[model samples]
Target: MNVLIAMDSFKGALSSERAGKALERGILRTSGHQTTVCSVADGGEGSVHALAACVKGEYKTWQCRDAFHQRITVRTLLFKEGESLCCAVEAADIFGLHNCEVSSATAATASTYGLGELLNQLHGHAIHKVLLFLGGTITTDGGLGVLQGLGIRLYDQMGNVLPDDCNPLFAFDHWDEEAFQTVRKKLGDMKLLVGCDVCAPLYGKEGCVLTYSAQKGANAMQMHKLEQQLHLLEQRSARNLMQEGCGAGGGCAAGLHILGAELTFGYELINRYVRLEQRLHTADLVITGEGQMNHQTLQGKLPIRIAQAAKKEGIPVLAVCGQREVDCIALTTYFQGIFTIQQGIYPLHEALAHTEEYLEETGYQLMRLITMTAGISHTVLKNQKVTIAEELCRKGKTI
Candidate 1:
């Protein structure tokens, strides 16, 4: 049997490529089946590396700033799959909660300026296309910080430049138009695709600030402060923040939109590069997984999307996750089988630490079930053949 294994990262445990390999090892241990492993992510942290592994591309690192303006070197993927260079940038590399202690203060002050630095450096090298994976960001600066990195100067009516404060970003009455245009001009004809997993609007009671700011450390007051300002800024900017993905990366998607970037669902972009559809056609079974399997996975997570596609092709799909939160009945509609990496109750940290070991073990157990299933089918077929021959002998004797 041919099995296609596509998996996302387990977050703090296995990367997508590693997860795929672990699963592949389990399937190969007993089945001797043809297995194909593809690294996949839901357009979030580790996406750059995942897509890079999929395309056999080169990994490039950039010395840049984090959301806190600290020095750091992050990675990007360079895929020369076509005539131009395609670079994948994971937004979490600059503004992920894991990278810093995020609080309301951090939420109000964190900047995506590091993201801009990455883009500016790539533009300098005359790169062709850049895929900005806009997911799991802590900042809600509306991309002002991102633009600041690209040399866009925000100004007050009095002509003083705005500081790198999130609050003041709303107060700015104008920006240096020439500088803003220059970056866009320099990036002329270069397509910027912002890969976002969510379709949240930028400003509303249900918008990014109200929906996600609290998780990023915003308290009641900070939430109010951001809501009021985002409302005002949306009015002043005159750009549509009501579009799907506008709330991605804490308004970074909207900010990138201001920079002439097109918003595309993150997995869709990755799927294009991987050509996953064609591969699914020939596979007898498909195994897809992620860090978490929940209602959120329904919102365009790679594993769910893979399962959906596999179902269309009459291929059975199995899912293995680090944590399983989705209702089994609801999830089984999409996945024929679902497994979790956790063997027992453990502290979150301990579970995370043992994720890879658990995943390998889970893969092995699932494959054993497949082996049992095959054996049962063979036994049932043998029984049917014996019964048929016995009936035939009885009929001959009667004649």
Candidate 2:
């Protein structure tokens, strides 16, 4: 049996490469089974690393500001597709939720200005295309900060320029398009592709503010404020607020769309670059997993996308996660089996620390089960054939 293992990053525990390698180690323990490990991500955290591994790219470090206006260095993946120079940027590395303490104040103030600054820096690099992964961001600023970083000036109702380091949605009155047009011209013919997983619109009940703000640390009152501010921005800008994925990264997608970006599924984009379909064709079984399996996994997450693709080729898919939510039974429709790596109850920190070990054990056990089941199935079929032959002989004798 040939097994293709493509595991996503385990967030704080292990990277995609490390996780896949660990699972590979255990799978190899079982004799006569071939295994292939692929580095993969869903365009969230660690997406750039995954892309870099897939395409053999180099990392270019750039100085930028974090969500809280703190100076930090971010690594951008630089690679070539044909003769065109392309770059991949993970939004989470700039303003991701994991970088800060989640609080109402942080949610209110986190900005994507640094992302804009990064893009501006890329403009001088002669990049032919930019793939911006817009997941795991903590900001709810509606991309006002991003526009500001791109030289577009935002003004308050009093006609004062709003600071770019903070969320501008609440005080935004209007923006000057002249500077933005100039910047746009500077990026002439460079395609900007925004990758996201969610399908939420820009505002209203199913939009960014209502669906994701709380997790970003907004309280009830803050959620209400953010919602109203998003609505106000929608009205002021007159952009298509109802567009699918416009609400991703807290309306960052909408802002980038205004700047002429094409929105696409993060998983699909990565798969294309990695040629996952071609890799899956040779596998007898495909195994993909994430750190956690839950309701969010249903929202076009990486593992689900992998399973969907594998299912098309009639390959059975399995998933192994550190934990599994009781309510994510729907995942079974795609996966032949879902296994958790945890062996016993432990502290969260301990569990995270032992993720690789647990994964190895799980992989070993799964392979053992598959081997045993194959033998049992063969025996059962043989027994059935023998019984049929005996019954036919008995009928012949009676005749």
Candidate 3:
């Protein structure tokens, strides 16, 4: 049997490339299944690696400053000419919380201006298509800094231009679009694709500001104030364009949406760019997992999506995870089997540090179960291939 091993890693944890290959090797040796390893990243940390593999793009490294003004070396993608892919990058990877401390909220002020810098360089290269990866952001303010970097100006209540920093949230009055006007004016056919995981709007229960602000060091009061500021920004932004991904990355998604960016699932976007379904069709089985496979996993996480896709082809999917809080019945409907890495009671830290070993063992054990159920292999038939009335997104083909 043929199989594909695809997995997504947690932030600051395993790399998808490593996890995919590890599962592939384990399945091939233990289950006698011919396997292919396909690494996937969902616009979080390993996104650069995933995109590089997908388009066979080259990595170009350069020195840049973090959110704290500390100099660091960073790598960006270089796709071929006429590729038409715009890469929307979140500044968090460069100004990650772990990378720097928030001495003052103002310390989180690098601006995606670096993103504009990348765009300028790409424009010189004659590139038009853009894929914006929005994740792991450190800023809690509305994306004014990014707009500033792109050459837009922010004005205060008095109509005086405000400075770039966290304080703009309080003093901002309106946007000046002169900077990004060049991008629009120069590239008539330019397209912006935003990679986002959250569906929350700009400011509310699920909005980016209230939900993610604390993680960026906002206190309860600060969170409240930031949420109010973003809410206003969202209202102003909504006046122009429909709120598409407003809830993504602290309303950064909303900001981009207003700027005429199209929103797509980060994983799904990567899947299309890489022809993920074509790879799935070639596999006999599929092994996929994430850090925690719970109820939320069913809500558009990479592993669940991969399982759903494979199921349409009658390919058995095995999910191996670090832990699971949801029952297996619901998950088993999509997966051939679901197993956790933890054997008994153990701290989460212990499990993460030994993720490689636990994952290998769990995969090997799953192979044994598949072997025993050879007689009941027909159970895999539970999810028979049904004709999807719409286009086959996996194949990039319209049915």
TM-score of each: 0.84, 0.89, 0.80
Error of 2 at 205 (Å): 4.1
Cα-based lDDT at residue 399, candidate 2: 6
Model 2 reaches what TM-score against the true structure?
0.89
The alpha-carbon deviation from the true structure for residue 205 of candidate 1, after best TM-score superposition, in angstroms, is: 5.8
Per-residue lDDT tens digits for candidate 1, residues 255-313, read 78877899988888887777888998667778888887876576566787888888677
Model 3 over residues 171-274: C-alpha lDDT tens digits? 66677766556545654456677877555567776666566666666667666777777767866665532243566655666666656667877787777766
What lDDT, from 0 to 1, does candidate 3 have?
0.63
Rank ordering of all candidates by TM-score, starting from the highest: 2, 1, 3
Residue 54's lDDT within candidate 1 is: 65
TM-score of 1: 0.84
Higher-ranked by lDDT: 1 or 2: 2
RMSD of each: 7.5, 6.7, 6.7
Best-performing candidate as measured by TM-score: 2
lDDT of each: 0.76, 0.82, 0.63
The parts of candidate 3 lying over 4 Å away from their true place are 81-92, 96-113, 158-160, 177-189, 239-244, 294-299, 326-337, 343-350, 373-399
Candidate 1, run of 10 with poorest lDDT:
381-390
Candidate 2 lDDT by residue in tens digits, 175-215? 88688778767766788998886777888877888888888
